[model samples]
Target: MSDATTSDPGTRARPVDVSERVALLDVLRGFALWGVFVSNSFAWFSGYVLLPRAQAQALSAPGLEAVVSGLYHFFVNQKFITLFSFLFGLGFSIQLARAEARKSSIVPLYSRRLGVLLAIGLVHLVAVWAGDILSTYAVLGFMLLLFRQRSDRTVLTWAGGLLVAVPLLAPFVQHYGPILLHGAQAAAQAAKASNEIDLRAKEQLLAGLSSDSFWTAQAANARFLTHMVPQSKRLLWMASILGRFLLGLLAGRYLLLQEVERRRSWHHRLLFWGLVLGVLGNGAGVVMQRLRLAGLVDPARDPWMLAMSAVMEVGFLGLAAAYVAAFALLFQRERWRRVMQVLAPVGRMALTNYLLQSVVSLCLYDGWGLGLIGKLPPSRCVALTLIIFALQVPFSHAWLSRFRFGPAEWLWRSLTYGRRQPMRLAPGDAPASMTG
Candidate 1:
């Protein structure tokens, strides 16, 4: 018998299993992570600041553009990142559950993991691109740890408040903040744009690709790091990225404590409402953008425009939750379960795939490689995502067949344990049975 103390004085302690892991959740995470690439592929490939506007303008006609915008408005951007954030929260809760079961301290273990992640993210940011989110997530994860032992209600209350407060105040800050701040931001953006334009021009004029392109790219990137990243960080904080992280952590706790999918009828209802709200909120954004384009209104400076974006963000959160619920419920079926099981390996090795994305993007976009950035249309980008994902599916399965863990996962585990972890799937090794 265990001797752990419960929140209630009369309750007996239960034994904890620290190694307990959720395969299905990991599979769902893999799906959500991949969705990010799907949603961001067009923007990543095209270097477009506003993807919806680019899609709208690049399509065959105004009517077609509206259709494309309407489709993407309801489906992309807002949802994928929310899904990833929610999964992060879910992962944190899972870690907590295992720690509690084993009567182990979660802080040390999780802190080490986050520290490694931050280091990895920093390297990735400077060496690859500054748009990396992992470092931001690592920073937010540290903050989230402070709330680990708090009651779900407390966490939810605080998270809800932050989520609402941040967006509500964003417009006020953007509008009322010092004129100097705005001027500085504009100057920073102009300088960065000018540098980028110069690089692009050089690439166009140069007859053949050479080692010089790499040096030039690095030089341009250094300027962006110096002049733009700090300002961008300020804007990102003001835009409530931290608030979203809190919301995600709250949602994760809810999923763990409530066993959200076990309640089938409620899950279905949530899914239905998610779809309905997502369509309505995203539609509003589309309409506003269209009107702004037509000169009927100026949404860029409007508070209501910020509100619309918030609504869309909420729609995304709701839909992502619905997806989790639906997937959990559907996973009871054998065929569906097997499909997800295949995905579990990829999720387990997400760090590898995430970095793989950077490598692939660099090859496709950089002057030293294919150099397709700012050239592909939305449709072709979508096609590229499909092809890449297809390749990943089989590659993941094949790699997992011969190994106990993904290469990156093995390395992380080895570092965490301060010892070499086994990498091969032994002859007698067997896959765990699926469970809800």
Candidate 2:
């Protein structure tokens, strides 16, 4: 779909120069990871919804737990990853456009990139954590090719339709999901109670997580992944992901991010409408969940749960968009730009940092090291996440100061071309404004 195939298949794309980088993109990546990590801490490491509501609440201060639940469910969950997905699409668009502009073969290199991502994702799923999204992202990336040649208007129409439509339908999953999940949990509980396996095997394959050994962890991960990768959630999430991807693709194609100052009114409207929808939608969902938790309502019988959940889905997306708008608005100012620039290194090495988050979380919370697993409280999870990311900030700054690409990024680039990429900036090369 990209004219990346316009030139001879043997030809290579042009190399990236430091000055071509966009600090804004990097900062956004860094910012997104923080929220992404926070959202992930609970789900990836510990069960979120499956936990006893009382026990979950006990992890936080008596009253604070309610506030945390409201804030996280309404404001944080599912939002930042939406932003991350948008950014991934932006990267894909930029790569395709650059390859076409240079008249170089694109699909070979692009496919290679996706292949590496898939490989990493598999490793992440089996060996590290079964909650990996990289595999999904990489797999769906191939489908993006079908829409590559479409015009901006066509893309926007499809993107807008998806953004509005998919989320509204997510409620169907909630309606059926509980029934399906309850059945599975009942079966697992029954089996465990019957003691159908040896003690060691039982521990390894238990419903609760255990990562004490590589084989044990692998068994645990595989078991979890089976239940996690269901068709319903996968299909719906792909819809949401594609919607964001197409939106980012549209922006990247138009280079809208390059001239933020010129789009003041657009940014203002986005921030306003985005916040309005996001806050209201997610807020309503929070109220519903709260009522259900309070035993005042049967969530399934309440027809409003469907509508509320649907609104929350769209609202969360809006909140992510608002964040992007807020960042764009701030970037228009020199002073704020300077302060935010600190996140550039982290963003620039996003691949490395993301994997790093997974690795550390696995060690810290999984059975491999501390065996903390589901023991952490929600407030402690938030606190630990902050501490972990704060350390990564300075570490990223230090690593980028002496190298060009982050270690994993370098490896990915090298693997794409079947040769090692340059790892150090040239003498005259300086960090660029944007990384295209």
Candidate 3:
């Protein structure tokens, strides 16, 4: 992350107390954020809609299929979000600690932070991609404050129950609940997916041959936009994402109260168990998929498939948590620390970088921009993600070196407080004294 140096003449001589220890967590956040981008890049550049059997199935190859399924089983919606959520929870605790040290009110200060996050998320959703998590996290954070003073055991018990209950209950409710509840919505979604796939396929076929096909191009663009808006909204209901979020909250509460990462042997034990469970869960998922493909089982009608998916998700999250704690405990040296420090800046400015990803990707892949969607392969997508992240790291470091906060973060703080916040940083820059 960027070093804190005051640049504003008015604040040049003030003391700054940004926690340097959190750099480790920031590095983990960077890793999680990048993993999400890797997965998103596939959809952003590949013109591969993840729904409607035809387009999704078309992308499947014997070799790639296993890779994709394995990834989906282990990483896709599980690990990355889990990491992000845990960071959020950890951040909450960090904020509280800072507030307490200053004898400030935690609620007002945190509420302001969440408000800023919500606004940033809204911009990300409507103006950019709709699969934004900031708004959701911000909303949930407010609810979490109620338990801020609760014992760690209470937080863990409630969080664990919610984590398990949401997924297992959601599917059954959707399946058996009144049709007026979610059935019509589900049916509409399926129909929309079918139509979108057909439209995209036609567009791809035509665009492959000529650039002068204006009508087809226009139709394709319209269909793509129409499909994406609702699709992003639908994500709120996805059991996987919500479950990860809850798990992250649980971890956050633990870290805030327990300092779980401080225990070396416990961290190792978690790592070992996480690895074992992850292997079993992912292995079971692979077996189920293979069986379904081989006609030995039918996942569409079988409850076992869903059960397996749940297990895999839990395992993946567990593994991710363990990995994060292990890294915190083990990689505290200079070389690794420097790498993490670089990542910390970007992670600290996650909102800025996330929106930046949308902007940059849109320019490179969207028809309205560079129009490279559906043209790149998985390897190229990964390459681009690396390139973009590399540029962002230095940029973030430079920006933070001279400023009190990221540009977006500054704006968020300003709006939340109803006043202009100091932005530039020089030696001894200090944040404003405020109640939590």
TM, every model: 0.81, 0.86, 0.76
Question: Residue 345 in model 1: shift from native, Å?
Answer: 2.3
Candidate 3, residues 190-214, lDDT tens digits: the string is: 6567666756754653353224443
lDDT of 1 by residue, 1-436 (tens): 0001122233332211112446666677678767787766655434543224444366413564446546665677657777677677766766675567666676877777778778878887777765677887888889878888777688777766555655556655654453356685774576567657655543432322222376655455444455545553355443355555556566555564236455667667767887777667666767776787777876434546666546666666667766766787777677888777766656656777777777787677656777765556556666777788777767766776677666766666666556786777667655332222
Alpha carbon lDDT of each predicted model: 0.61, 0.72, 0.60
> What's the C-alpha lDDT at position 76 in model 1?
72
RMSD of each: 6.2, 5.2, 6.5
For candidate 3, what is the lDDT?
0.60
Query: Would you list the rank order by TM-score, best first?
Result: 2, 1, 3
Candidate 2 stretches with Cα past 4 Å from truth are: 1-11, 46-50, 170-208, 431-436
- Model 1 residue pairs with clashes: 16-101, 16-102
Which model scores highest in lDDT? 2
After superposition, the stretches of candidate 1 with alpha carbons farther than 4 Å from their true spots are: 1-20, 50-56, 59-69, 179-212, 232-261, 300-303, 431-436
